[model samples]
Structures are given as C-alpha cells and as structure tokens.
Target: MALNFEPELPTFVFERTYTNDHQFLFAFPNEKKMPNARQIQLRRLYDIMNLSVQRNDLPRARRAWSILARCKEINWKAMWRLGITLLGNDARVMESNPRKIDYLRTMLLQLPEERERILAELVQHYILAGKYRDALDELEFYLPSFPYRDNPVLHVYAGLLCIFVAQPPESAGVNEVEETAFDSNSLSRAQIFLEHAKALDPHNIVASEFLHKLHSISQGPASISFASHDSEDETHTKGCQPSQPKRKRSNS
Candidate 1:
C-alpha cells in the first residue's frame, strides 16, 4: 500500500492558530463579521497540507507553503506556530518517510530565520531521518543571545533523542557486529541527557532521577568486565584470520 504521508484534512479555522488568534479577531472591525472565517480558512489550509503530506505531493504542499512564506501580518507568529504543530505531527512520519519530509523541512528552514525554530525543526528532521548521530552533533552547537526565544520542546526532544540514539546496537538495534563502533565518550552523552532533563524542568523530580541514572552509568559498574590486554590481541588476530581480506568500497 502507498503511504499517506500528508496530514488529515485541516480544519484550519478550528486549529488554535486561527481559533484563538487575537489578530484574526481584531483584523476585522466587527468581530462577528468574520465570525467563522478563521475556522474556514484554517480548515482549507489543513486539508491542503494534509493531502500534500499523505500523498508526498511536494508540488501541492510547496504551493500552500508559498502562501505562508510571504505572510507579512503583524501576527506572523501563528504561521510559525502552525509549522511547529507539523513538527510534532510529522515526527513519526519522518521516521518512516525521511526523504519526503524534506518538502516541509526545506520550506520551514527557508521561511524561518529564528535559530531556535530552525534548530527545533532540524532536530525533528534528524530524528525522522534516523540520523541520531547528526542530532547529537547539533546539541553541541550553542545558540548564544539568540534573536528568537529558546524552546523548551527542543530541550525535551534532544534529551529523548540522545537517550534513544546513544545506546549500543545490540540494545538499540544499531548493530551488534559493530558494537566496537560505539564511541567511548558515552559519559559526555550522559551529561547531555542530564542537562536537557534539567532544562526541561529544574524543580521536577524526573530530571534528578535521570541524572542519577546517568551518574551510575558514568561511574562504571562492576557488572561490565573488559577483556585483558592479551584477550584484546587475541580478538584482533582472529579478525585478521579470515582467508581473504574483504575490499573496502570507496564512495567514488
């Protein structure tokens, strides 16, 4: 069966962006003149976006997106908010149809100049692409004195993504054959998780709970036993013992 990547028909007016929009309310002198116009417009946009998403109809989505891009209203804020809603909505979609997600990603990035907004979407993109490594790389980037306010959601998503991505393949489904590839700098990761947990909630008990969990891992447990130097050499020799060495592929 073909994928229905587009969002369900959007009742754009009913979406909080238009429903609770003070600007849309105040745009007209008579509040009730456009009583439900917001709802109708919202529904129209939703349907279009939904159709585009489900069908991977980039052309259609891009056309609808173009309208949002040029919006010069005082409350351009709602547009960005709508974009954010897509992030949450499409998280699982990205995981399944990573390439198709590029349609929204390219548009969102182009239209949004705010670092926080861009980073939030970027994090979602990487998560959808199953490129946790890149997502981890982004966390190290600092957004000092950013023009746009920081989003707590980014912190939360980053923490969850880090935990899910950093696990060993055997546990995380990355690769038992490449368990040796898991970086030894996992202590640093533990630190990141705790920090995000803290940022997500300073007084909350869960941050402390996760921090404690990370602390235990960083300290190194007695349960995990490393091989001796002699054993390491023995394993290395066994790896080279194959009758023929496989040729490495070069990406030419």
Candidate 2:
C-alpha cells in the first residue's frame, strides 16, 4: 500500500468534472429575452411593443402586447402599430396564442370606423394569417360603416373582398368578367366593386385596370371604356384600341 498525501485543495478549490451521478445538479439561466410582462401589463404593452419593433424582433415584440391585450382601449395609433407589425410568419405564433384573436378584434374595432385603408390592411392581415373566418368577420365589421373611398382602386378592393373574401356570385358579373372559374361570382362581385369605384372616380386607371383584369381573367373582353383624366393620353383614351405595331417602310 502506498500513501501519498498532498494538501487537499480545500474541497471548494478542488474541481470535479462529471458527476458520477447522472442526475448531478447543473443550472442554466434563461437567456432568451422573454417578453417583459409587467412592463406591458396595461399601459406598458405599447412600450414593450415599441421595444420589440426597435429590435426588429417583430414576432416577440408583438407578442409582448399579448400581455395587456383585450383591453380595447388602445386607439387607432396603437392599433396601427400592432396591425402593421403583423407579418406573414407571425400568423403561426398568433394562432398558437388565443390572445391573437382578441388583439385583432380589438385592433379592428379601435380603427376609425370609416378608415378604409386601415380596414384593407386589417383584411390583408387576417387573410395572410389564414383566418378566413376572422377575415370575413373583419369585412362584416368594416363594410357597413365605411364611407366609400374616393379612390380609383376602391372597386378592385371591394370586388376582391366580395368574390374571394366575401364569396359573392357570378351571374351578376360585371362587364369585364369574361368567364373564368366562378366567372360569374368573381365577375359579378368584381363588377360591383369596380362599378362603385368608377362611380366614385370615373377616370381612375387603377379601377379600370382592375375591372379589365378581372374580366380578362374570366375570358371577358380586354377593353373597358371610361372618361379620361385631366392629364389624359389621347392614344389611350377610353374605347381606343391598342396602337398597332408600326411597320418599317424600308425599300431595298
């Protein structure tokens, strides 16, 4: 038996690598920046959300508001902040948290009842999130109270909502609807919106184009007639045919 004694490193100084016990205690601190709860519990959700936006941690940033959501007290400014931050990928996270539904409902409700652009955005957000039911609910929430926009794109927006989002019919299709699938439904709704848009702003190309495209996609005629704007192009005037390819008059 050989005995070699060295001064013990005082147990504290001595180091042990792996604990023979597989269950040795080890600890790690939570490093992930969890949404700060107390900060946004009510008045602070806006601040936390702003911080999230500053970091471009849009998902977690928006999630921060889940803390104080359902309040419905956040006005258009706050709602806009949250609504715009919602991106395509955020939908999954939103679906996971039931808080998402509350946030959206409150957000839409808070927007000025007549703010069509915000309503469009709200619709777009719901559509991206694949919440068709919610999207439809949004339309129902908005369409009635909305003052008709004087925008040229108004019809396009309305048609899209009615046919695709709102599920309108085809037989009542607009003039441009040539006949694609649900040609009748899409055309009809498209016609309705486009007509509305045209009625609002007769010379708007955006409205004209949307109607033209919808009808074209449905196999309808490619042209539409509308009065030109103040800065109108004579060649592209309403009812004017596309210019023919000019032939080069070259003689050998």
Candidate 3:
C-alpha cells in the first residue's frame, strides 16, 4: 500500500533546491537556473564563513571569498547576506578580511544596472557593522529614486537604522542639549520612515513591530527627556499610529 502522507510545501520555492552538497546541488545547465543556484550558494557561503569564524580557518574563508569574487552576477539579497557573513563574530577575521568587504562593495556599487538594489544591500552592510550614519546616508541618497521610495523594506530598514542613530553616543561630555536635539531628530526621521512603510503596505508586520517599539521607546524615561518636534496640524502627529481606512457597513 502507498503511504498517504504528504510533506508541507516550502515557504520559498527556490529555497527547497539548496542542500548540504552545495557544489553538486547547484550544478544545473544554463543561466536561467543560475539565480536559484546562486541564492543557494550565498546561503551556503554564509555557513562556510561562520564555520571559518568558529574554527579560525582563514584558508577556508579565503576559498569562500574567492568563489564569491568569481561570481559573474549576484543579486542584492545575496550581497547583503555575504556582507553580514563577512562581519560575523570573528573580529580577527573581519580585520584581516577588509579587502574582501571592499572588493564586494566595489563590485556591487560599480555595476551600472540596479544601483538602487546595490545601495540597499550596502545599507544592510553598514547597519550590520554599526555604521548607522553610513546606512542613513545611503538610504537618503536613494530616497528620491522612485524604486527606493516604492519599496517598503527600504523604509523599514531606514527606520531601524534611525533608531540606532538615536542611541546615546559612547563619547564622554556630550552636551545634554545637543544630544537631546539629535535624539529628537533621529526619532522623528525614524517615525516618518515607519509611517511611510505602513502607508505603503498596511499588512507589513515588520513595520508594525518597529512602530510599536518606537512608541515604547518614545515613552521611556530616556527618550522622554528629548523634546518633541511633531507638528500640531498633522493628523498622525505621533507617527506611531497608522491611519486606518474607514470600513463600509453592509446589510447581512
């Protein structure tokens, strides 16, 4: 008798193609199959890099770096994952691998096509590295672009990075007045980003979650010390709340 059970479908169709035997798994024919294969390799590369970090295996990490460098074309998502892998817990490895990061960034940014996509990945890299200002600058650079403006994820990321910018500076003797002003500015910017993201896609849970955090943080004693810059005329002045559309009642 045949078994009557069926497996659950993968959340992502292409993610199913990846396996531990990455080399053989991705050896498919033609460029059409390359996208899926490349995505698999990117994930595998992160594992390889993590292993390298755990074992302090420089040669293995180098091998992964070489493979990434040799890739003919890579998407923004892969680039973002690879950059995070490069910035893993291994401080020694990160210091030694600066060239790899530089190479990847240059390769991605220099590409004539999909500059916005590459810029988005770069923002991810900067954020992961705790370079919040750099991440914000990158987002601002692309903000005017229609593609960036249309993407909800970019807004979410910008808002997240802006929160980092609001963090208290590590330096001593930071004037309370100046710090408060900076915090207010950063929070306002973050609110705008999250609000825009919610407006664009009401169903985005990430944006919703960030908005909640923004509200919580805003009310916290630390954030309360900062002056509010919200305008009186705006309906959603607080910026934590998304405007809800009116529902029509119908006869049953």
TM-score per candidate:
0.44, 0.43, 0.49
Candidate numbers, best TM-score first, in rank order: 3, 1, 2
Instruction: Tell me the tens digit of each residue's lDDT in model 3 across 15-56.
Output: 455554434323222334434545565555645645675576
Q: List where candidate 2 sits over 4 angstroms from the true fold.
A: 1-51, 57-79, 83-101, 113-115, 131-141, 144-154, 161-183, 217-252
lDDT order of candidates, top first: 3, 1, 2
lDDT at position 233, candidate 2: 22
**Worst ten-residue run, lDDT, model 2?**
23-32
lDDT of 1 at 181: 36
On TM-score, the leading prediction is 3
- Give candidate 3 regions above 4 Å deviation: 1-25, 29-97, 110-117, 170-182, 216-252
Q: Model 3's lDDT to the true fold?
A: 0.56
Clashes of each: 14, 14, 0
Candidate whose lDDT is highest: 3
- Give the per-residue lDDT of model 1 (tens digit) for 96-210: 2454345445655566555466566666555545555555455444322233224444554444444433434433333343343323355455456557557656874544654
